[model samples]
Target: MRCAPSAGAALVLCAATAGLLSAQGSPAQPEPPRFASSDEVNLLAHGLLQLGHGLREHVEHTRGRLGSLERRLDACGAACAQASGTAAPPPAANPVVGDAAAPETLRNLQVQLKAQDTRIEQLFEKVAQQQRNLEKQQLKIENLQSQVRLLAPSHVEHKVIKPARGKRLPKVAQDGDTAHNASRLHRLPRHCQELFEEGERQSGLFQIQPQGSPPFLVNCEMASDGGWTVIQRRQDGSVDFNQPWEAYKAGFGDPQGEFWLGLEKVHSITGNHGGRLSVQLQDWEGNNESLQFPVHLGGEDTAYSLQLTAPVASKLGATAITPNGLSLPFSTWDQDHDLRGDKNCAKTLSGGWWFGTCSHSNLNGQYFHSIPRQRQQRKKGIFWKTWRGRYYPLQATTILIRPAVDASAS
Candidate 1:
């Protein structure tokens, strides 16, 4: 097989050929020009020598780098073998011989080295891309931090105002005093004063003592049905029936329309069996009847209520003249019977004033006697029972009364 000469050997062969050609040139060929001085020739030779030295140094550096790379690749191969749980192959023999096969092997090694260099360049590009991505993410984080700083103050402003522990806070009235007074005036139905007077007169007939300071505050109104309803019961030292009387009266009165009278904070005395249960009626007035009948305690829920009907004066009988000169003759249903003219109205045997059915009579067959259940806890608030049997708290400090609507109209 034939082999190509190396670069240095080829250069030497070319120089020798040129010398021979010059010596064998024909006489007709013109002689080439020579340097004018030996110093000029020497200067040119020095330049060539320097260039050759530089080339040699570059070649040597390249060889050293290539050797280092080979060593590193061998080390990496061994490590990969170890990681893979395999024995490394034996090292290949060096191809330093001056033969065609040796040259071919060297060329193959050069091609492998170039391929490794290209793979290394690709890895460097990936690292650069990852670094750029990291920088972009860092910039985004900084921008978000700046936005949060800008919005922090407004968020703090919206924070809720928490009250101090173990301290009671006074309620802030939504409507001012003037507005409240205006609302009261607006809610007052026509002929409210007359209804208030009638309730007071009837209460006196039953010997129902007024409770709380200024016992009577004429702030009630007449309902659409001409029935009187309590609007507010703000008397001191009394249980405030904050609900309007019209709401309770509507449940019993005739659908076609009926008159009702409500008294606020009347007194009641009850004698059950041998035990006596006395409670000051919050907003009811009817009779001063006393009972000696056997009464069960805590067995059943029973209450005493006062039902006053207007336009039923004929059923009530003659008006009883009082010392105060307030003549009010209204029918009153107490316990189970009508005590309009019963002289023993204050003294009874089995019934006096209870919400349950009485053998004597049920007033006009209207069940209008019910006192709200007192809360077991000592909370100073009122709760109303809904039809669904749920109790909801109320902040009723005022009473409101309006005329009852006709049943037909409703």
Candidate 2:
């Protein structure tokens, strides 16, 4: 490559050496221009490939002159030997006064040669550095391509599926309807308490997506204190609560009226972030009472078991209530998860519940408009035994939950 400065250097070296050896006076040569910096050296490499031909011609002319001077010196020595039989005086001793600056000129030429060589080496180094940088950039691009290939399949598998407008959402099957509902999750609240905090004062139906669960519609009960998510209600005999395992597991009914929010959804809400459960009951005589408990409901593997702490608040007057059914797994007519061995509490009481040797409170029991005169028939009606006897059926009942307002939840 012309990157090497050898050609220009040969010209300078040849001219300088010839001037010194002949002990001859020559006109001072102009100094070659030097590179300002390494960057300029690179720019020159692109503009020009070879040193100037005029410089080469000048070096050849100097070499020829030096050869002529050598011949004349040889002839003069021969002539002196014949006349006085003595050798000619050494050329250095007979040096002309005009040749005094030959050594200095040679030194300057040598310095210029060395400088050009250094600039060429620097240019070579810069090229190598740029090549290394390009190689590193290529490696980075390859790594990113590999990552994209690894993640491509997952992107296709989990692609968000938007539901058709003006249609009810399909039932939770695989991923619990997460694929179709995920698009709306960002706009929907996670629970009724979140809605109340967002300044929703009116009680109505709203879509919610609990953590790890798909979005679904629920009725929000907006009270003065906060909002409550209504999970189950028995206002009228509109929706039957006497269902098997699958019906309760998948939930049934509407949010505007009486409905039971599915067991899986209740687990999603209460299991991840615990909640406070409130049971409100009204007797046929219009006597209303309520009870509150800090609760956590388990998942389907645990039969959606209920876990309740002591009642934090109760309006049962002086009634001594024992929360016996709090720790039991839920039971249904088909799949018995209750503790009772001989008879399924769900079959005996004609409804579903978390029952241990039967229940003290059976909210899912059959709705009775009036008090049953037969003692056996009363056990089939909705009853909270502490406030009212088992035979007295309730007029209306609501089961709601609000996120726990403790430090752990925060």
Candidate 3:
């Protein structure tokens, strides 16, 4: 991926001496910040918010300048028009001029007037170009602000859950090993597991292929299990589904290779509610792909009835996709998460890490999740293909999708 230049690059456009002083002041002051495990998420959320504020302020400044230039141009046009209206009163009969001399002087005056008109046109053109550039930059700044809000916990909700049918699943999955193909999903087509796993904690591509068909709708949601800390459920579900859930138009080769439900958990720096992620899919018809290994939210693991319609087979390389999201990659369960008597309250899924469950500071206390330091530097593979060559990194994040009731029937 191409690394973008830092914001400092934008400052160079201002006056050179002012930029130098600003540059000196910046280094002399404290550095912007390098995310810390203790508060990475907050830093990011807050930093973006601050940037949005700054951009809005600059946008206002540019708008004000444009207004001033517009007024001056209008005045210049008026003066030019008034001068033209004064039919040159027969130049006071040049007392010593031959009628030819009068024409020469008038011609010189006309040349000056033409030059002035040309200069005004050039000025207007320059102003118009500036206005367009300012507008483009404003649009970009606003877009970035919207993304900041998306990553903010206060603005995002998680989507989660799925079900199982006939067989029995283990009481709990191994906290340390999720790669063991002995898992049920391994026996299924490879693409099933690949898509789900790729978006784990945010790594996968969801292209919205329409092929003159209905547009598939996707949304994400977050939930708190009655007894499990968001972290514990994330780390210890026997029926885990941390895999990426991908969507392609019908008949995309019936999926490939092998796949499985993968689940993992991560602790918030502040240790609030632990996060849980699961990935499982079903078509409109009746094909049960990963029915053997189910994924879940907070409830008991049971077969979720999902129906597959006529399998949609798309032309070789055509499938529309959208963003499905990702989940955290680390496990959060441990001895510290056990809640003794509080059966009604939610417990931590990841245990005693900074944000897991404990009697004093419960997981349900506040929904704030901390951004572990170094996470920004870690590649989550979570990129959204907003368009070609436009992959927006998922950064350190999570995606949860709740399947429809009928989605489990198959």
Q: State model 3's lDDT.
A: 0.27
Reference-based TM-score of each model: 0.17, 0.51, 0.24
Pairwise TM-score winner, candidates 1 and 3: 3
Give lDDT tens digits, candidate 2, residues 242-296.
Answer: 9989889888875556788888877766655678888999998888998887777
lDDT of 2: 0.64
Q: How many residue-pair clashes does candidate 3 contain? A: 79
Residue-by-residue lDDT tens digits, candidate 1, 248-345: 22222211123122422211111121121111122233322211111222211222232222322222231432333222221222322233443422
By summed lDDT, the worst window of 10 consecutive residues in model 3 runs over 247-256
What does candidate 3's lDDT look like per residue over 6-98, in tens digits?
Answer: 222222333354456446555655777643342443453454445445534544454454456445444454444445534334555541222
Q: Which numbered prediction scores highest in TM-score against the true structure? A: 2
- lDDT (CA) for every model shown? 0.30, 0.64, 0.27
Mark the regions of model 1 whose C-alpha exceeds 4 Å error after superposition. 1-101, 153-410
Residue runs of model 3 more than 4 Å from their true location after superposition? 1-102, 151-305, 308-410
lDDT of 1 at 159: 26
